[model samples]
Target: MNILILANQDLASNLALNLLLPSLQRHTLRVFLSSRVGKPGALPELKRLRFFEQSLCNEMLFPHLPEPGQRDAQYLSFSQFTPLLTSPVEIVNTINSDESLSRVSALKPDLILSIRYGGILKDPLLAIPKQGVINLHSGLLPDYRGVMATFWAMLNGEREIGTTCHFIEDDSIDTGGVISACRLTVHSERSYLWHVLQLYTGGCELLLDAVERIAYGEKPVARPQSTKGGYFSFPQAEDFTAFSQKGLKLVDEEEMLEFFKHYYY
Candidate 1:
């Protein structure tokens, strides 16, 4: 099947692409990375994009992986078998205007996979694929829908955090058909960054499952999300601080060191 991936350049989206792209050999895949690059002095841009990067970077989720080797390994493991992707992967610094949605349409993809593309996909654009578009969200749909669902789940002290692969409807947000979901328990001692990376890794598997099921002409499942349990956006600074203070249950430093060594080595 021919697949087109719509994604951004941030860690989450980039990691998703890194894993997903190499797996494209199984299906004909084309990737278009929506660039998050900005002008040096762009006022609102720095506040919105750079600030989030800095804040999340400092939070220490995956351990300061400044070294390319460490970062590559973390991304590759999540990719599983996708690293075999031999198809063309194009990085577009901006998909807002100059992006030829037409060129993407020309690919005539059997399916489109959207993972945090960071922009609204209009009908004229989403209509290109022969099969419908789908998204793998960080939160389990019908409950937590929107940006930072993983973080929001952590803040809420939810026992489980997971991924939702859903069909794309005409709506702007998460109002869509359910495809499939995968969830895992959040360890009290784990940092929010750790929790999110786990979710990110798990999401790749769930997404692959959803793709295979749909490719086989099967109806995965579609359930309406409860209006009562609605959307939540990113948390504010004060809220984050409060959650940080209470969310993590302390583990002995030696135990933590041993655990890190076991995983890192």
Candidate 2:
């Protein structure tokens, strides 16, 4: 099977891909990493989130990322793993552009998988893959939808957070038929980033199972979202203040460093 993966260029997405790609050795794979940049005149909160994520990536991930054309390292991060892939990884700014459309059409993908991809895919690109597109969302559907779902869930004081694997049938963000979902206990002691990163472990497993089912000619069951779920945009300053009041940190540097040891070591 020819599979095309669309994901954001960040530590969490990289971690998910690292866990997923190894199990997909039987299929042909191509990856497109999104820059995840917002439009000009974006809100301060959005800018802050972007800055925070970029800072973490720069400090913790970029230093260890393999350089262009440099492949053989004792330990391989997602970027380093590219040299061993059947297709060269692409860093895309406009996923719906004519050039991107043409490139995807050329691949003749059997399926398209999306994980934390920043851009919204249109009909032209969505129509290319025979098996259609499946997305791994960090939050459960019909409840939490949109950006920074884990943060939103934690802010709402939810007892458990979940990851949803669903079919992206249209341009509507995360309002798709549920293929599968897995939940994790919300640990109050953990930072929002920790919960966000942990969600992908189960997220990748669900994605792998969905892909295998589709590849084996079995139709994966997709349950329609029965309720109209609320959508969450980036949290504002007040929301952050409330979160902090509840004793939650946006990030725990020490915990993150410890988590990265698994990939780096």
Candidate 3:
């Protein structure tokens, strides 16, 4: 099966690539890079991206990797994936643009996969793929829908935060039917970034499962997302205060380094 991926260039995207790309030897993979790839937008995003690259450099790649240091391979060998991280994928700036949509249609992909591509796909693009578009949403559907869901989960002081893989539908934020979901317990002791990474790392496995099921002509269960409103946007100041009160650090460098050690090693 030929799978087309639409993704940005952030830790989530990078982590997704680390897991998804190498595991796809059974299928054809082509990537449609999000226009925002490699470009930092807002301040919070900028800071986290910087931290992810610099702090996690020992375990992953960076635009500029630091001076050489002897270290055993963590989880996956970062050296082997240099090609995927450095090489450019075809950029699809607007998923709705006629030219972009036409270009995508020309690919004739069997499946279209999206991981925080930062753009809404129109009906034309949706209909192009034989299997329809699958989105790896940052949060669980019908409940934690929208941006910063993992953060929201932490902010709400919930015990579980997770990633959801769903079938994309027309004209909604994350109204897609659920394909699969995996939840990680919110260890408030863990860094906020560590929790966020679960959305990418664990999420991709769910995505791969959905892909295999669809490829085999098996109908994976698609639970309809709830109509009741629980949509969320970026967090407000008070939310951060709540998060602080819950003893969740905005960024915990050492905790995440240990997290990488345990996850990757």
Better of 1 and 2 by TM-score: 2
Specify the poorest-scoring 10-residue window by lDDT in model 3: 63-72
Residue 222 accuracy (lDDT) in model 3: 91
Q: Each candidate's lDDT (Cα)?
A: 0.64, 0.83, 0.72
TM-score of model 3 (CA atoms) = 0.81
Q: Please write out the lDDT profile of model 1 over residues 15-69, one tens digit for every residue.
A: 6765566555678776666654323244353354344343343235344544434
- Order of models, best TM-score first: 2, 3, 1
| Candidate with more favorable, higher lDDT: 1 or 2 | 2
Error of 2 at 8 (Å): 0.4
Candidate rank order under lDDT: 2, 3, 1
Superposed model 1: Cα runs more than 4 Å off: 36-88, 93-99, 247-265
Taking the candidates one at a time, how many backbone clashes does each contain?
6, 0, 1
Worst 10 residues of 1 by lDDT: 74-83
Q: Per-residue lDDT for 233-260 in model 3, tens only?
A: 7665677677778787777768656655
- TM accuracy, model 1: 0.73
The prediction achieving the highest TM-score against the true structure is 2
Model 2, span 177-229: residue lDDT tens: 99999999999999888898899889999999999999899979999997688
After aligning candidate 2 to the native by TM-score, how far in Å is the CA of 11 from where it should be? 0.7
